[model samples]
Target: MKISARNRLKGKVVDIVKGATTAHVRIDIGNGVIVTSSITNEAVDELGLKIGADAYAVVKASDVMVAVD
Candidate 1:
């Protein structure tokens, strides 16, 4: 899926935690890297986001503020 946001991170789905109305999708970036995002239940089911699946974590923020890590 394409989004207007430029800060998009792509990875393979590693884990999925389902909740009452939300689900957490975990993606493996590489070299033991992992990132998770909270998505809607409908998105989880519609996109078939599951373990060992390819997915893109597109992050859209109202502001693009940054700080030194």
Candidate 2:
């Protein structure tokens, strides 16, 4: 409910791909852009994440990396 991270992009869940331990939660942040977060399968279940549901992609500035190719 309360987080310190400022980079919170609200969007609708587009897809969910689950692996052995981690799952990739894809959220469409609008404008044909999607933000994917790799989280534990348990986290995904606990959060009850499903397609067409609202979710937020929380990003920490310190952990973000920029690459120029």
- What residue pairs clash in candidate 1, if any at all? none
Residue lDDT tens for model 2, 19-56: 99999999999999999899999999999999999999
Clash count for each candidate, listed in order shown: 0, 0
Report lDDT (Cα) of residue 2, candidate 2: 93
lDDT of candidate 1 over 6-30, digit per residue (tens)? 7677789999988999988899978
Give the Å shift of residue 62 in candidate 1: 4.0
Candidate 2: lDDT of 57?
A: 98
TM-score of each: 0.80, 0.90
Distance from true position, residue 6, model 1, in Å? Answer: 0.6
Q: What are the Cα lDDT values of the candidates?
A: 0.82, 0.95
Cα deviation of 60, candidate 1, in Å: 2.1
Q: Runs in model 1 with CA error above 4 Å?
A: 61-65
Which segments of model 2 are wrong by more than 4 Å?
67-69
